[model samples]
Target chain A: MSRKFNFCAGPAALPEAVLKQARDEMLDWQGKGLSVMEMSHRSDEFVSIANKAEADLRDLLKIPANYKVLFMQGGASSQFAMVPLNLGGKGGTANYINTGIWGKKAIQEAERYMPVHLAGSSAEVNGLSRVPRQFEIQTSTDAAYLHYTSNETIGGLEFDYLPTSDVPLVCDMSSDILSVPTDINQFGLIYAGAQKNIGPAGLTLVIVRDDLLDQAKAEIPTMFSYKVCAENASMYNTPPTFALYLSGLVFDWLKNDVGGLEKMADINQRKAAKLYAAIDANDFYSNPVALENRSIMNVPFRLADASLDKLFLAKADDAGLLNLAGHRSVGGMRASIYNAVPEAAVDALIEFMNDFAKTRG
Target chain B: MSRKFNFCAGPAALPEAVLKQARDEMLDWQGKGLSVMEMSHRSDEFVSIANKAEADLRDLLKIPANYKVLFMQGGASSQFAMVPLNLGGKGGTANYINTGIWGKKAIQEAERYMPVHLAGSSAEVNGLSRVPRQFEIQTSTDAAYLHYTSNETIGGLEFDYLPTSDVPLVCDMSSDILSVPTDINQFGLIYAGAQKNIGPAGLTLVIVRDDLLDQAKAEIPTMFSYKVCAENASMYNTPPTFALYLSGLVFDWLKNDVGGLEKMADINQRKAAKLYAAIDANDFYSNPVALENRSIMNVPFRLADASLDKLFLAKADDAGLLNLAGHRSVGGMRASIYNAVPEAAVDALIEFMNDFAKTRG
Candidate 1:
């Protein structure tokens, strides 16, 4: 079967090699006589799989020894509530930096559990073109923790620099985790829905510092408590076994095949640079986000002739570049070039865009 | 590659046909040039897959038009909190019937949200050998709802009859949901974790009556709200798209390959009966649960001599009968013959058990 360059945001494209390996092992995992999906979560076979996935991820991220990496379900949306429920019990208001749709949603969900203070925001800037600078952010006097979206998936806005906070730093890195190396010790908790840079939907990757685990509200649901999940090694219940297994394959691909996050970041920068260069060179296309804040993972652009938008997407699909349409809330074009997306895929997209601009500009 | 019998309780065996189909389509689903895992949840392709799976499940269970089916994440453990958070907002004590481990866990989670009254309990019966009869279940004076585990995976106990109440009746049918046909009209809501009888570990299936959707507590997390989920058609956020796709294939297999639940139920009864008869005839093996209460899907047994337990498990593994060891909490042998576990697998297991008894008795 022919593979296409898929650019859909969240539940996005997986690495072709990982999918091939998964396919080969679907019926009988390592001659275990059963699919990974069929194994008991408590079984030695599955526990090893779970541990290896976490270990490989830790190695890739160079995560500190004291942090617990939890393989959970319910996506990053669940973490919006979980973050506040787990961290907001310290009798202080939580601070949030509103940058885009995802950041706003996280604030709205957190408001249900604790008092939320908007310490920093991009709303003052037209169209959320950039993020609030680190110096501009103001942590609340009684801030339990400071939370922000590392990269806004839909808006294609990203923080070029990390924001500092006196309270522990928490981030919703749903779209950008593992795309670059980071100092895990700088954050209290960081979570990403696996659908984007990691593996598939259903599996959420949560990395939280050991010290922050015990601060959960007493009234929080047991399942919502990060400490419980950490204590159980993320098997407080049956985790998405197949999803975890597939993600483990992805972690392996990242480490061995792509040569870790440094190499991945280099490739990502080059890929995004080429695409952005193509956009800037053409009068037919224009990107809205400021140069400094442009996300390396997601690039959103508009055709100069709005009438040609439908034709552009149609031609791109015909050229085997699928899911180029932007999110419904923001109607334009967004190419989410996650770690799985190869530079060749970006090359093909650029070639197609150039041809489309030449023929239809 | 040779396939063997796998009897994992949850995250259990799936139909061989379903696995083969999944393997074949892992890279390119329906010539769509992308894996089901790679597709956007909001795309037409994945949406159709989700819709068809829900439709097929509704058809299999004969679910009425008044119910909304939700494909959620975080398993039944998450549901333990969600059930109370969603149903306990009406300001009445929630009544729970405690029969086995799963039921007790459900009650414990509910107690964190609101006042929970134990309507009926099998603790008095000793070792949870039987379920409380309908007449024994006494709903509270101001009962919000009656909740029970229809099939306890760990204890191998199942409710032979429905528990009736004036308020909404909720059931966690995690293990035995698709094994037998039932009247969906009897319960206000029924939920299942897909790993057992449905598909995989990452997806949770919820069927809630339309009228009960609005009862969620205001303080509940948005991700925990059944009303919001139903309104968004279970896509308030990115769903576990690949898991949902695989489950749809399973539903299709259940409908087309095995016929409807009537035929499946007949086969399931026969499979359980033969295994139970084998256990009864051999003095070496003893099933603890009452005959009527014994679970059709999960058959838990113990060795006459406790020392033989390890040896029995070893031989079972050597003979290609895998995962026969019981839950760690109970510490015996459990053969979870889910709907996907073929009758031939059961026959092989019986032969192995009979031979083991004769040689070592």
Candidate 2:
């Protein structure tokens, strides 16, 4: 049977090739007579796998020499708390740009540790637009860092440019990472949950400048300490071994098969354009976000007639286009087109959407 | 090629049947047309899978209605910090029993949050034995909880009985959680990392008394809050979906094919006995732990002639036995016979040990 295109936000779609390789190697990996999942993290075989995963990810993102790559657990949400606990030492405050749900969550978590400054926000615009130029950024010369969500999944909004700041720039790039290329050197720390564009849900990838690692609050847990995780190569405890292995396969797939992030950016641009064009071609559907600052990864649109929402979802499911329902916060539909989503899948979804619209209209 | 028996401590062996089922369903789970890994956590299909996994685990352990089961991340080590942060609210002390590496780590982490009372300890015995009855278990009537490592994985030590206390009992059951039948009602909280006796390495299982859920410090991250995790059904963030799904398969294997935990306890007892008998039969190899309190899961032994250690490992590898090397802290050989270890494997290991000893002698 043909595979379905999964549009899940996270625990999201992975490259079929990676899944196939994992399935084939589930019994015996590299003639070791044991599955990768079963190998001890201390084993030579697993050590090699873990090291390669980190090295390949660094290469793909062009990570600078001063940054340490850490494979952590508990997803991006966990990092929201960890970033503050590690960076917001003593009574230091940090600046946060609130864009949408993820940004607000990060700000809320950061508030638990120290005073958080809301630098800029698109929340007043319902997160449908980018932060306006007239908006003021509350920067503290003595602040710990500036935090922002590069991509907001639930609200289908994204920041195209990095926040201009002298302070270390920290970002939650959970939804948009690896889908497009970015300047890794500009950020002091960047973290992304693996589900959307990496591999699966359990693993979180953290890249932090080495200079920023030494100042964790004295009371923070060792597991939450960036210094401890970096010192032990993220094996301070038994890491998500299987998740790391799977993510390594994805990194290899992205580099060799999917043609790296440069090519991925090109292809993603095309896919997003096609879907957006289809939505904008007629008045049958509407995307509320401003066209200039629209997100290329997530496109949330609504039917012209609200009554057809259920009908659209049912027909889409029948056609094997799944997880098209938008997050409850927004009522219509959402199509998450991460890096693993092929152009053909988006084309099929557009075709299906057009056909359904024509018949219903 | 035939499969070999693996003895790695964590990210260790899983049931062959579970691995097979996981591979079979990797691309499409139960005709869902999407891999379980790709499904959204909020999807009905995955929600049902998560609910069933929790229900089955509760049934296996006979969990009381007052307890809540939560699937979390960051392994047992993260829980080390989270437990104290949640329970030790506003400057309260908790009692800790130090038996081995895991216990020591727990103490070090807990000290970051609140005062930790060194109640009972066998670390002075080089972790070769469990805590003696004469050891004082200091407890203040106002103590937050009593924490202990039920089975020390690195030190190969196990607690024979619970400490007498009216305070809440919290256990890090990472290494030997389901190896035998457990009285779940006795403990306020029991947490296990799913690597040794469970499924994979990413997911952590926390069984907390419902009444203890509201005790999380408001400053704690929402992801680490027991109340938040319980309210969202462990899907507060995207859970380790693939890990949880595989763990569900393991729960089924344990309950159905393995004749439940009672039968598993008997089989595990027999497996440990066979290996221990070999060590006892001759003076060539010796296990330092006392017999009555020996762990049924991990058995660390050493040769009388230290020079033969490498030779023994090479010969064992040639015989398709792997990961017999002990942790670096202790220099010896360890054979961890967790629940997935079949009787035939134990018999083969015994035969190999006898032959090696006879030849060397």
Candidate 3:
């Protein structure tokens, strides 16, 4: 049976094939008579699973040897605290580019550990655009790192290009990590919470450069220290075993079933374009973000007739298009077309939007 | 088909019924056509699932209305840092009773936040016994809280009674929670990583008194703040949904199949007694912990002739007894009899031990 298209901002849809494979393996994982959740993290069986998952993820992203991939817990929110706690050595200053809600959160968290300088901000533009080209980035020679949210799930804003700076770049790719291809070597660190495009909610994937690993403050707890996690293979403690298992399945699915990141990028772009075209086709609906900076994974749009917002949602829900409601901050509708969201689902959503627009217009 | 009796220490065993229910619900949950993993955490459907799980937990534990139960991410290791970050307000000192590896780690983490006084320790005794009665606990009037490890999985040690102090008692009950009955009111705070007796690895359960809520440092991330997690109903961010669902099933199984905590406690006592007796009856096997303070959940025993240890483990693995290897720090065997470990499994292990001991002797 076909599944309804889910446009949840996060804890979002996973590939049906991946889910089916997981379901089939839920009872007995490779004839081990144990679900992956029940196995000891240190056991040979789990070690191989964890190792293969990391290897496959490395291959999918083409991560550099200098970057260590750590599977952690507590999501990106935890990393909001951890990034500064570790990277802000000696409580120095750092650069923050605020594009939206996630960037603001990252800055708020970094403030506790160091002086966070606002390098660039789009919030002044009413949270609908990217970092302005003319905004000056005041980079101190001693600044620990320059941090930004690559894609804002709530604001539906994304950075079209990385800011050019001498300082190390750290990006929170929580909402849009593997949806498209990018230069992995440019950033000192990149962290993504896996609930959106990856697999499950509990696991956070961190890719950190080797040089930054040992820069954590001595006062930081071992669990939060990037060096400790990297050294121990993110098993400094019992990780979210099931989440990691699902993430491994997702990585494998991306490599084999989805035809790797290049294909996924193309498919995701098509999905976003189809939905965005429906919004731009008539004055009845509008997407405020600039075309060049619009997110390929999340498309936030609104009806011209404000009174029709609730009606549109009700009709969409009735038609089995769920969680299309936008963030309250944005006050519109958002369709998060992540890797797991099939092209057909996006086509269906576009059809529904067009049909709804005809009556509303 | 009947399942094998698994004796893994953690990420250990879960109720077969719970696993079966999870398997059955893997594809479509209650006709939702979405697996629990695929459900948005913020969706009304998943919200209800999370709420019911919390309510069931509170009901099973008979937690007071004044206490808040938080289903958090990051295992107990994260709690080691978070407890200090939240409770160790304004550089206040706290007392930590070091019983085993977990306690030592907690102390190390807490020391980063404030001056942690070592109220008592069992490490000098090789982590075999609980905190010594002769040890004096120096509680400062300004201390934040007193901490202890209720049960140490690595070293088969457990507290026999509560420490006599007016300070708020905090216990890391990671290994022993839900295996027996206890007074929930006695603890000002209790946190357990869910891999052992609760449900899965990703979720950590924290029970804290309401009065302790406002004591956290304001600088801590909102996600790590016990106050924020409680206020948001543990929905501050996307939680481990599938983990929470499985945990709810385990809670139900605990209520019905295991005859609740009271009955489980009695059965656990009997099971521990039977196994300990077998080890003590024959000098070929020995448990180092003082008999009165030994853990009923984790029984770490060693052969009198150490040369036969490898042989014993090899034979045990062939017989489907896995993860019986002792922690590297403590060179022996550990049989973790969690809630899911049936008495029959303990009997089988004892039978195997006897058969092996005869030949070694």
Candidate 4:
């Protein structure tokens, strides 16, 4: 069956190869006579699946040995609360760089746990069009850590360069983790909800430096504590076994098909440019994000005539481009061309956008 | 392909119909051109799926209007912390009934939040055989609530009758929730992790009484707050969407195939009785739990000779009676015949047990 070009922001498009692989193995994983979904987490088969997923992910990004890759849940949102609870030690404050809604969410949740230093925020810049420039970043003295969102899925903005910090720099890379290359050593911790670049919605990937594990609060809930997660290798409880198995398939696809994150970023850059170029060709479509900080993973735009937005979406859906409706917070069109979205899909979207503008304009 | 009898404790077996449906719809759900895994949670398609799942569950259980059903994560283990953080009203002690490992875990986590009254515990009765009788319960004058595990997975103990409490009664029905029918109005709250009888791992089902939500502390994390979850209709952030979808399919299976909880419970009862009878009929096998407390979900038993336990499990697995190993905490064997396990599987297990015991004894 022909598949549509799905541009969902999250719980988003997975590689066709990965999806097909998962489907083929759904009833009985490699003749084990049970779906990975039904496999016991403690079973040798699932344990190996979990291990390979982590190892392959580690290899994909050249993650350092000191960083423990954890498969967790509650997504990056939960980490917003967990970071402060785990890292916000006694008599210490954590600095937050608020780039967009995700960053603000982390900062707000952190406030409930510790002294939050809203060191820098893009709100002052208006419309959240761009990330805070290097010189604009401000942090407090003796801050426990600095937290920021690497990619804002909603605002369609992202940091081009990793922010420098004397203290540990933690990143919420939920939307763009494997879409681009990253140096694991630069950040003390990084977390991503496994929906966009990864496989499914239930799994969350956390890469935490070993040194920070000991700083977790004594009273933090066992499930939320990085110390416990690291100690148990994220198997403290029954994990999302099926999702983890699918994620390993995604990693395998990334490694064997796309080569690696460096090549992945190059392909992603090309895909984003194709959509941006089509938008730039006509004033009928307008993007609010700054050219310098626009997200390659999520490209949100607006129709020249607000009334035509529904028509555009309907036409797009009819033409097989899906979930292109932007976040309700940001009205108009949002084409989330995540890693799994082939360049062919973007080409199809670009063609549709040009035709859409011509008809509406 | 014929499926094996998967006896995993959690992340356990799923209904064959549900698995087949998921497999068929893995690539495209209802011709939406995107798998449920890929559909945006906020989209109309996914929302309908989530809403219908809750509605079906409510219909099956007869949950009152005063209850809010929340699809959450971090499993039932996270609920241990959330119960105290949300229901442990400020300065008030909560009564806890310690039945087994799960109950003790809840009590331990609750201790970190508020003073806990060990209202009753079965520790004095060695091997966690039976729950304390009605006369055994003791609650503090100012206790916030009473928490108990409806079924102990490890020890194979289940409460035949719901415990009465003056204060709110919070039950972790993780292993036994949808397997049996219950009057929802009797309990202030009920929660269950999905892996056992619901669907895949990672999704957690939470039934919170509307009034009990207000008791949550101001300082509780937003993700963990019943107020936030209820207010947002379980979409405060991106939930485990695929898990939620699978759970809906499971609810459908329970309704359409199994008829309802009453019939499901009856079937489960028969399956448990058959296995228990097989054990009791021979001197080669023994179950530690009292007959009244024997769990229909998890049937744990020991071999007459402990040395033969490994051989028993090996031969059982060889015969496709898979994952029959007991919890590490409790040795011997545990055949967790959750709702998904058919009567035929239990019959197969009982038949295998008799033949193996005859040969060994």
Every candidate's fraction of true contacts kept comes to: 0.86, 0.74, 0.54, 0.70
DockQ for every model comes to 0.88, 0.77, 0.59, 0.76
> Across residues A169-212, which tens digit of lDDT does each residue of candidate 3 receive?
99999999999887898999999999998888889999999998
RMSD of each: 1.2, 1.8, 2.2, 1.5
* Top candidate by DockQ: 1
List where candidate 1 sits over 4 angstroms from the true fold.
A123-128, B123-128
lDDT of each: 0.92, 0.87, 0.85, 0.89
lDDT of 3 at B158: 85
Provide the global lDDT of candidate 3 against the true structure.
Answer: 0.85
Worst 10 residues of 2 chain B by lDDT: B126-135
DockQ of 3: 0.59
Per-residue alpha-carbon lDDT of candidate 1 for residues A1-361, written as tens digits (9 for 90 to 100): 9999998887889999999999999999998999999998888999999889989999999999999999888898999999999997778998999999999999999998899999998744565388888888998899999999999998899899988888899999999999999889889999999999999999999999999998888878888899999999998999999999999999999999999999999999999999999999999989888889999999999998989999999999999999999889999999999999989999999999999999999
Q: What residue pairs clash in candidate 1, if any at all?
A: none
lDDT of candidate 2 over A225-275, digit per residue (tens): 899999999998898999999999999999999889999999999998999
Superposed model 2: Cα runs more than 4 Å off: A123-128, A134-138, B123-128, B134-136
Which residue pairs of candidate 2 clash?
Answer: none
What DockQ does candidate 1 have relative to the true complex? 0.88
- At residue B168, candidate 1 shows an lDDT of 94
Per-residue lDDT of model 4, residues A1-361, tens digit only: 5689999999899998888988888889888889999998888999899888988998999998999999999988899988888887655898999888889889888888888898777743455367778788888987999999998999898888889989999999999999988989999999899999998998889999999988877668889998898899899988988889989999999999999988999999999998888888889988888788889999999988999989998999999999988888868889999999999999999888888887777
Ranking by TM-score: 1, 4, 2, 3
Quote the RMSD, in angstroms, for model 3: 2.2
For all predicted structures, in order, the TM-scores are 0.99, 0.97, 0.96, 0.98
